[model samples]
Target: MNKKIINAMLVLGMTAGLAAGTCTSAFAEEAETEEARGYRFTWVNPIVGLEYWSIAEEGMAAADAKYGTDTQTVGPTEINVDEMVKQIDAAVAAQVDGIITMALDPTALGPAIQRAVDAGIPVVCIDTDAPDSARSYYAGTSNYDAGFQAGQTMAEMTDGKAKVGILMGGINASNMVSRVEGFKAALEEYQDMEIIVTEDTNADLLIGTQKAQAMMQTYPEMTAIFGTSSTDAQAAGKVAEEMGITDQYCIIGFDDMEDTLNYIREGVVDATTVQKPYEMGYLGVELLVQTIEGNGPEEQVIDTGVTMVTADNVDSYKE
Candidate 1:
């Protein structure tokens, strides 16, 4: 198996440090909320039905229960910018106390976010972000940094030489793009690491797998595959294992989904980037509520931080 272990020592060390060092109030078990009574907030999820998004929804529910706030969760079953925009518009028209959303597509979601702010609704973007939008706060991972680490991790796993293929959820999504940019920047340090191609899966697992297979077939030299969306790594690893070429590729994924963990355990995926969707959702509500009460903090961004997961330490994450 050419599937080498990444610098497991480095990964473990960094993970241990990031566990405490990346502290932000948002990651706290409870972000401070005071008298949020009668404040009805709406959380707009771009992919409401996907398993990944469900974690964020759980966080929203936890925050709602803890703070005694009414949060209305609404979105399309699939990732639909038009439906998300319509939902946001509806929230604004309904005059909800505040709104929460993820910046799946900055250009498409930006204007709607701004409109909500212009209409006096305090908006918070979680998990993903649209800095250009009028969102008052962003509570989630700094995607670029996460991607950078992913690139570095890949370099170690592939011994600093790999024909890389990147699978993204959406090419136009700012957060996903940022991860790609950071990934490219990190790989620039290694002269032998080259990105051969990038494909968009629209965050669909089947499409991701199809693209992964296609990329492998086209770029026969590709030694590493990076997935910036949750399903990308699963796609790559699944294809590699099925094609009997898992040894030829070092597979990296985003987020710690259950199936992804199983892949790591089975020696299919080398590692993955772990983001706190639940914490992001939980913190987003508090940020919105704070802004509603006119006590909004000066800092507009509440980074939830990110960490790396690998086969060596995947068990720790599973529990």
Candidate 2:
């Protein structure tokens, strides 16, 4: 969509919490240094200190090294929508030139994003999306497609027949929802493939493990496990190890986090879908800078794409 259209939309239902988020001094400092050095962009995440985000920061650093953009990564210590919204608000208050963030919750994050747009800062969504938000571009996996792929892989591994369980970090995340939908759709082709349960781990591996164990105990006939979160598969795998049932059930995980990859290498996880975190960071910065300069992104959605990893290709992603 054009800037005029988006701006008009923002003006129509501008959120009431226009100035609620506190803009911290760190954001202010980056804004202050912009003119003296280079364009400043903030990369905000729903949860910080994850290996996934760290890898993404590597891409951000690469973009910074190449484009000379001053980028900072910040987010809540946990998966809190309020903090995500506040960070965007903070960015706007600091007058940051651009924003790169995942649409953790559109209902909340969307308005904050619209406010940032109203303030003239370009916003880009990465790793996940909130199509309802005011983000100008998205650089990440086609989450639904990734899920469909996982489903197909599981079906093949299980010979198109298995009782399945789904593990999700959070139930409300749009990306996870998309994955679940796509996974279900794919499994429809196999009448014997059933998703018997959906567990919400609240992004905690321990909870995920407990949930996985509970699901397994509650549904002992379950023959497959599908994890929609980065560490869900690992959690399930740990449970399988404890139960002395490794390689007995088909386990599909998400992302290429180190442990997930290690699981693949060790033949614990049957397969995993890997999203390009680095490219999301690299291209997010690229798109944000391009939008800020008015040079044009020329495209709004950039699918950094997904890859399925197994022992066959696990060696390359082990690091």
Candidate 3:
């Protein structure tokens, strides 16, 4: 072979070998950098079967579809604080990518939430909040604001001079406590309005009914009643209807439940403050997805907000 041709052939062989080495190195780097990039999330609510929770579930499902992530929902059947704590611990053990919880007892669940945080899992609270907990964010209604609105509506319905009673789900629940405080503060603005009794039903509809009935018997002059939770509201309305005082006593309630809406339509409940549960759930998941993707705020508290729903606008909220 000619020297020129021989030299060109040798150079081509060397060039091909270099290119092959570069390709192999690039492949090895890509293999080394491969990572599991999907996420698993958990949504914990106080209970199921309530309309509010179903709405939240819808929002959560929507998020799961949108983000192509696996999501699970679990919680206590009766808003039991211990049960909720167990669920949280289980989710942490499973090493979920994120957690969304509704705290029935803020202090009780703080440690468990902190444990999840310490484990490097992101936690977001929804529907209820544990401000002192290790949750990265809160997405839900402003309970205090809802309660204040309920109080103002109650005062107006009672002509500002009514003796009032309050029915609460549980005192341990921070959301309910904030609501009661806001209601009381708003009622205090009316010189003639007074909260003569406050009772806890443990979030049982039947117990709420019994306590409300007993309160009515004890306070015959009561002209209005406020229910700080869905179960309490339904019980208060049912009790009033059963006692033939539905028309005489103005009932103000919190959270939009089907029963509450029905009572509003029948004039049993004068008004209720409706929180956007679906939005709360949707935003909670959206925030969680952002956090998992490293695109969310370090700490955020989103107020889904509340609005007064009464007979005047009950039809508008029907669907």
Query: Residue 40 lDDT in model 3?
Result: 90
Residue 288 displacement (Å), model 3: 1.0
Candidate 2 structure lDDT = 0.78
List candidate 2 stretches off by more than 4 Å.
1-37, 317-319
Clash tally for model 2:
0
| Candidates in descending TM-score order | 1, 2, 3
Give the winner by TM-score: 1 or 3. Answer: 1
The superposed Cα distance between candidate 2 and the true structure at residue 49, in angstroms, equals: 0.1
**Candidate 3, overall lDDT?**
0.77
Worst 10 residues of 3 by lDDT: 16-25
Name the candidate, 2 or 3, with the larger TM-score value: 2
In the range 1-319, model 1's lDDT, one tens digit per residue, is 1222223223212221222112233333455654548779999988877877787777777678667798888998767899999999999999998999998888999999989999999899988878777888887888898899999999988889889999998888788899998898899999999998999998899999899999999999888999999999999988998999999989998988788989999999999999877777777887787787787556666666777899778876533
Clashing pairs in 3: none
Question: 1-319, model 3: which lDDT tens digit per residue?
Answer: 1111112112212211011112111111222312334679988778866667877776666556566666788886677889889999999999999999997888899999999999988898887878777787777777887788888888887779998888988876899999998899898889999889999987878889999999989999988888888877789889888888887788888777788888999988888888766666656776787787788643366665676889988876533
| Candidate 1: Cα lDDT at 55 | 76
What lDDT tens digits, residue by residue, belong to model 2 across residues 1-319?
5321122112212111100112111211222222323888988877898777777776676667667788998898678989988889999999999999988677778888999999999899887876777788877778888899999999999999999999988899888889999899899999989888899987778899999999989998998999998889999988998888986789998887777777777878889888767656766776787787778545566665577888887765423
